[model samples]
Target chain A: MEFNAIYVIVAREFKKFIRERSRLFSAIARPLLWLFIVGAGLSRLVPSDTGVSYTQFIFPGILGMTILFSSIFSSISIIWDKEFGFMKEILVAPVSRLSIVVGKALSGTIVSTIQAAIILALFPILGFNLSIVQIIAVILICAFTSFSISAFGIVLATFYESYESFSVIMNFIVMPMFFLSGAMYPVKLLPEILQICAKINPLTYGIDAMKHVIFKFETGPMSPDIPLIIDAAVIILTSIIFVLIAGKAFERKG
Target chain B: MSIIKVENLVKRFSDITAVNDVSFEVEEGTIFGFLGPNGAGKTTTINILCTLLAPTSGKAFIAGHDCIKESAEVRKAIGIVFQDTTLDKDLTARENLIFHAYLYNVAKDKMQQRVDDVLRFVDLYSRKDDLVKKFSGGMKRRLEVARGMIHWPRVLFLDEPTLGLDPQSRTNLWEFIAELPEKNKVTIFMTTHYMEEAEVCDRIAIIDNGKIIAMGTPEELKKAVGGDVIYIKTTDNASAKNEIERLFKFNVSEKENEIYMTCGMGDTCIPEIINTIGEKVISVRLQRPTLNDVFLKLTGKTIREETSSGNDIKDFVRAYRKRH
Candidate 1:
């Protein structure tokens, strides 16, 4: 609905994204710090059960981390827009709430996917070779994961009015989701209660799916926490559901 | 013909009624001003008319479309310049208009031409490529007005379009807005606290405490006050006020340190007031009734007293932030 409205929103975001060079730099640099500094240091002590190196074991988690931060913060633009009153201009336009939600989700997905791809290109530097097919699959997985998180972020954004309150709430939600996502560690190593939380987090499926693509073997303790089909299904289903919820949330703006 | 209509609109925020049983019609191709003090439901009424808010009861229609049921059509038919600046400060003036055009679904072929025309109309054509963050307060407001009209909606709602601008810029922006009804064939429904700005409107509605206290052309409203106004500042205002009320039998109101009253033939009454009142008068002035006087007579409060309260600090901060 109102496809041009969606296009304009996407284009406007892209222009702002390009202008803010520091944001792009920081988005890329944060994940690299985790991958190189944290992953490299932990790789020595946290030896993997599988033949895969510890650096490679958490590499998928690194990608998940990149997507999680970038995609979720992309919705922060909404809070900024609200603060600056630009959201009122858009809300008064002849566009559907669905178009606005889809446009935001698409822009977030694209931006986070681009950041994830930059990190994915570092596979050679990490001494792990990925086939072109595997690389494309990983990118697709990153896009789906980013879309779901972005939609969920939009859903949360609708409930907030100020950057301070939203940031406070985001700290409460984002950090736990990251820790429980099996991003820095395997789900099997987690406490039983945390394992339940990991199962609930959509990002867990995302990182697990990334593990399926990058790792050579699927039958080990370090293997994906869930089946590939289940991971994909959860992400796709969550994305659709979050987007619908976000669209409905916007209706209450009236 | 009436292009905008509201039938007994009432909006309540929890237990407080922000807009209560208000109804009015705006004719096509005219400038209708909504004059009210702060929190007088002016913005609330505009929000409902623009389809940004739904009323708890009653109905509003814009350009023949029901504001609640046919909101999309109403949105398509209206453009608003909010009391605060809403332009994307990161984007260029041209890009902002183009974005608005797309959101309003302007024809692809005509989009560029429309954007150019509006930029030129607002006199921001020279700075079209510059980021809005670099613009002065006045320039940003002009661009917002330009963007509001780029879509050529049937009605343009301006909620205090020149609230923060300097007096010179206010006059300049007001000139552009005053021309829209005739030059662009668009109905203008604006809310402002500036009495001078409200004077230019084809019709004015003075709202207070969520009610429309008076509605008419500026002349008609001012005439209803039925006298000239006299301002007296004396050494003793309490006795001066009581003395003026006793001697002239006029309804006296004290604002700040000055005592003012509305009385017929104020020109002749001024000398009599100075001579007969035993108190030493510090100053005396007489003037014809203005829209502010009418508002004061109706509401027992001066419109300027309410609006000018916090403006100095805001002006200072804005002036300090100006970049070249």
Candidate 2:
């Protein structure tokens, strides 16, 4: 992996992401809508005995949603590159295919991290207070989640030839991954099958880790369903697996 | 020494054999053309040579590196302008070139100088700052060519570089392409179905139905199809052909009210032919054989006739939509 080759690809992708103003606007706006409108509306219905506001409960989930949507959509540029013939240029370069994958994955991770940071700015508004340590932990978790999901997007992008097919497949997978990850509600309260599905979702660990950080600060004693160590381990392992998958898929382009 | 060499290369896509047992060599510092109609495996052969598509059997090498086993080395030694425009529409021409330079590992300090030189070579330096989407088709094609050359590779592969351009732009592009060998010391391997375009090449291989039917310099291939071609439109064409055949001991073919004959020297034979076969000649045309005629004589059909079918039209439209 030539560092220069990787840097060149990363720079091009970042430039495109920054230039598209509408995309930036939407990346921030989509999750905020879900966080405020949906979270606020649902807060009224829940009983007060849970000891956490609905906004604070769903805040990590919204952060996961922001990272998920932004990172996955960043990979759509690969489909666009294929259609426009720019992919041939990249594939034929002297650099290894791994560099291209790294470049793309890192750029997507950056975009999603930035989007999540924007949502994080509303922490005071949601009436949640946290230490500097918790903020750093949340950022690191979001980065790992963004990297894994973006790698998954690249794997899907490699198989799809058009934007229409990619979007269709994304909708089918993304919604289920977010909904079943216990982003909206507690996994302990869900039915047995749904809880099992949540355990399988990699995003579940990401959100769980974040929730642990926030609730640990608020409630003083930590009692996460999954240990923080296990959550971090799963997210890191999933990212490595996805990066390998994406690299292999890229090498097999026909 | 040969800059490119292929031995019995074959590429198959499911039921279709895109390139079938094709073998050829391109010498260093020369322009080699692959002339074929659409779907005739021209692009497939180029792709295999450029290491974009792996051959199903046999092998190819670029600058002495096997395209498959040593693809990285081969890629380092060669450049490619694909059949379609590959420039990033969102980036300016200079940005596109700069991106390629870094990808190829051109030295950081030399990058600006190299980009400027190639841009000026293609006469695109003035428009370097404008986004590629604002460029004309000719400008975009020129920028693609410049981008391909940004790394300063030893060889350049252009797959149908002028496939869809106006006459003026096509001619201007060819002028720029023709100069690359002498000016930049880069060997060119290009593919085109157009006969006139192949004439500019130092040597050409005419491919049909996934096979190389003829290979030679343009003049040598034309001569192999015999000398000048004479087309005669006359009253009583059958008798006229027979009379000319008997008088000149030449093989004449007739197709729909016209008599076609290949002679050693058409102009020298024309007067004797007319005088001997008196009064029946309405008109006579004597012309040198073109690559199209060479293709026709070798494959029994013109390139256009082979691809002018209804299905080909649909494929053409589909390809057009894909490119635009």
After best superposition, candidate 1 residue A36: deviation in angstroms?
A: 0.7
RMSD of 2: 4.6
Instruction: List DockQ, one per candidate, in order.
Output: 0.66, 0.76
Cα lDDT tens digits, model 1, A1-254, are 89999899889988988999999999999999998899889989986678887888889999999999999899878988999999999999989999999999998998999999999999999888889999999999999999999998998889888888666756898888998998888898888999999999999999999998998897777878898999999999999999999999998862
Share of reference contacts found in each model: 0.92, 0.90
TM-scores of all candidate predictions against the true structure: 0.89, 0.92
Please state the error at residue B267 of candidate 1 in Å.
8.8
On the 0 to 100 scale, the lDDT of residue B253 in model 1 is 86
lDDT string, candidate 2, A1-254, tens digits: 88998898888988887888898998898888998899889989865454777777889999999988888888768998998889999999988878888888888899899889889888989888888988988999999999988888888889888777865866798888899876888777789999999999888898888988877443321225677889999999988998898999999973
Tell me, by DockQ, which candidate is best: 2
Error of 2 at B88 (Å): 1.7
Q: Write the per-residue lDDT of candidate 2 for residues B40-95, one digit (tens) a residue.
A: 99988888888888889998988889999999999999989999999899998999
lDDT of each: 0.89, 0.86
Candidate 1 — what's its lDDT?
0.89
